[model samples]
Target: MLSYALLVHAAPYSEQGALSALRFAQAAVAQGHRVSSVFFYRDGVHNASTLMAPPQDEVHLAEGWRALAQEHGTELLVCIAASLRRGLMNAEEGVRHGREAHNLEPPFVLTGLGQLVDAMQANDRVITFAP
Candidate 1:
């Protein structure tokens, strides 16, 4: 079984790239392949926002990704620089910026590009989903 790493660079609502990546990851796992990690970069950092509240009838993209991570033990990583630029912060960042709340929490970690490089080096295959 091949180990896969996914890189998503699109926002959930803005495009289908993230959704497609999720499906591919699920299918890969079901087929007995291992998914090492999912790296969210660029606008894709929006997927890690805890403030996302979609209509009940619509699918919650963030929740979907979170569930996948929970069930499959897949690492969910959002680019720190990209997330900061988009105002998506963890508790530490919120405290540093004098904010009362943070949008990124557990199951989604903020990391550097070095993590992406590491994923590429560790996984057997790296698939990128872009908008």
Candidate 2:
């Protein structure tokens, strides 16, 4: 089975790119392929925001991605530069910035572009979902 890595460049709420990536990953896993990681960059960093509170009737892409990670062990990574520019921060960043809260949580890690390069190098396929 081919191992895949996904790069998402769209926000969870505003575009279909993120959703497409999620479905692609799910389908790949169902077909017995391995999805090694999903790297969220550009506006895709919004998917890692814990403050997202979509309507009950809507499909929460963040939660869906989180569930995918929990069940399939896919590494979900958010771009550090993009996340900071958009005001998304993990606990360590929050503490460093003297903020009281952080929207980034478990199952979603903030990392550098080097991680993306690694994903590209390590996986058999590197797919990008962009808006």
Candidate 3:
């Protein structure tokens, strides 16, 4: 089976990048290809924010990505720098920055660019979905 690394680099609702990456990941799993990891960078870290509550009619892109990660046991990594810059911090980060609590949820880990480079090195394909 082919292994893939899905790199998402856009905000959740602004454009189709996040949604497109999710759809592509689902299709890849359906077809039996392994999605080794999903790396959220730049504005893509917004997908892991637990505070997002889109309107009823609009699709909840963040929830969808979270669900996919849980369902497939996929490694979902949010770049620490990108995440913090955008106010998407995990428990440790939130504490360090003096925030009351963290909003980033499980299955979404805070990591560095090294993970991205490693994923690209190991995967059969490194697919990027940008703004």
Best by TM-score: 2
Clashes of each: 0, 0, 0
Poorly placed runs, candidate 3 (over 4 Å): none
**Residue 115 C-alpha lDDT in model 1:** 99
Q: Give the candidates in order of TM-score, highest first.
A: 2, 1, 3
Ranking 2 against 3 by TM-score, winner: 2
Local accuracy by lDDT, each model:
0.93, 0.94, 0.91
For all predicted structures, in order, the TM-scores are: 0.96, 0.98, 0.95
**What is candidate 3's lDDT per residue for 69-112, written digit by digit as tens?**
88887899999999988889989888899999898978899999
Error of 1 at 33 (Å): 1.0
Candidate 2: 10-residue stretch with minimal lDDT: 10-19
TM-score quality measure for candidate 1: 0.96
- Tens-digit lDDT string for candidate 2 (51-93): 8999999888889889889998999999999999999999999
Error of 1 at 15 (Å): 0.4
* True lDDT of residue 7, candidate 1: 98
How does candidate 3 fare on TM-score?
A: 0.95
* Prediction 1 global C-alpha lDDT: 0.93
lDDT tens digits by residue: candidate 1, 23-115:
898899999998889999999999999999989997888998898889988999999999999999999999999999999998999999999
